[model samples]
Target: MFVIVGLGNPGKQYAGTRHNVGFDVIDYLSEKHNIPVNKVKFKGLIGEGFISNKKVLLVKPQTYMNLSGHSVLEIQNFYKLNPEQLIVIYDDIDVDLGKLRIRSKGSAGTHNGMRSIIYEIQSDQFPRVRIGIGKPQKGDLSNHVLSRFGKEDQEEMAITIGNAASAIETVVTEGVNAAMNKFNG
Candidate 1:
């Protein structure tokens, strides 16, 4: 089984914010795959189901962004899964808005969530899907990530989230290379 983790802060206040795009993608995947992510496990909201014949655990960590690793590590250890069997999805301010960058393994860069996962898991050799939110034009970075999108950007983000869900499906059904070829344009 593959463990798919989407990083974001929990609670209603964080919903629809740029930092919550990971959660949005998880929500999209849950709805599309008929998986209800209502179970609390591994310090996250999880739904167990199949994606193209492959058993999967869709997770939304409730430990907030910076401490996401705690939830992820629990699931990893419980399942005895290798890093390769894990797929992490989160937002990236460095990439252009509504875009995606898929990697099989890499550094966390500026994302504290990714950093925490890498630190707790003791490796960076895991697949990851990064949704672009773009950098702040001005003001504090935290404010920018916590802010909601404008009307125009919301439409674009909707498409992006759908694409992100599709990308993850491809990753599960095919492989990281195939997903990268299809969605990493």
Candidate 2:
């Protein structure tokens, strides 16, 4: 089974914030695939189901962003899955808005959440789908990430979230390389 994790802070307050793009994509996937990601397990909300004939666990870590690795590590150990079976979706402030970057494996650059995951898991060989949120023009980093998108950006974000969901599907159905080739710009 493949474990697809979307990283974000939980709670209604974080909904629609740039940092919650991962959650938004997971929501899109849940709706599209009929997976009810409401069951609490492994420190996350998870739904066990099938995507393109592959058994999958859709996960939304509820431990917030910084502590995401704790939940992810638990799930990884319980399932006895290799790092390759794990796919993480999160926001990237370095890329342009509404864009995506898929990497087979890489060190976490500036994302604290990704850093935590890599540190706890002890591997950088997992697949990841990064939804670009773009850098803030001028503001506190936390404020920029926590803030909601503007009206125009919201429209772009809607499309990006949907695409991110589709990218996850492709990652499951095909492979990371295929998804990257198709989705990455």
Candidate 3:
């Protein structure tokens, strides 16, 4: 079994913000697989189903971005899963918008959500799928992540979300290496 977590702030105000891309991917996957993520557990919404014949628990941490680890730790402990069974999806400012970078394990860097998960779980040896949100051209970093995409980028954002969903399916069916080879570009 694998726990696929998408890091994002909860609430309607943050629904379409750049920081919520992780949630977006979770939503996309839920719909694609016909799994309803309506269960309130582990301080997050979760949907259990089989993806590519592998048992997967789709998670959206509701503890907001910075405190995401609390929720993740709960799920991890409940499932008795190893660090490698965790697959996190979140936004990254270091990469260009609409791009993806998959890693078997790595540091969180500037993402507070990832940091929280790593700190709480006591491990970073987990697969992560980072969707690029692009650095802010100017102004505060918080503002950039909290902001919604412009009309020009909406199309690209949609495509990226879809790709992220597919990439996750690939990860479950094949392996992290297969997913990285196919989606990380």
Tens digit of per-residue lDDT, candidate 1, span 1-185: 88999988999999999999999998998999899999999899999999998999999999999999999999989999999999999999999999999999999999999999999999999999999999999999999999999998999999999999999999999999999999997
Compared with the true structure, what per-residue lDDT tens digits does model 3 show for residues 26-82?
999999888899999999999999888899999999999999999999998998999
Q: Indicate the TM-score of model 1.
A: 0.99
Worst 10 residues of 3 by lDDT: 166-175
Per-candidate Cα lDDT values, in order, are 0.95, 0.93, 0.95
What TM-score should be assigned to candidate 3?
0.99
The parts of candidate 1 lying over 4 Å away from their true place are none
Q: TM-scores of all models? A: 0.99, 0.98, 0.99
Model 3, C-alpha of 108: deviation from truth (Å): 0.3
In terms of lDDT, the poorest run of 10 residues in model 1 is 1-10
In candidate 2, residue 143 scores what lDDT? 95
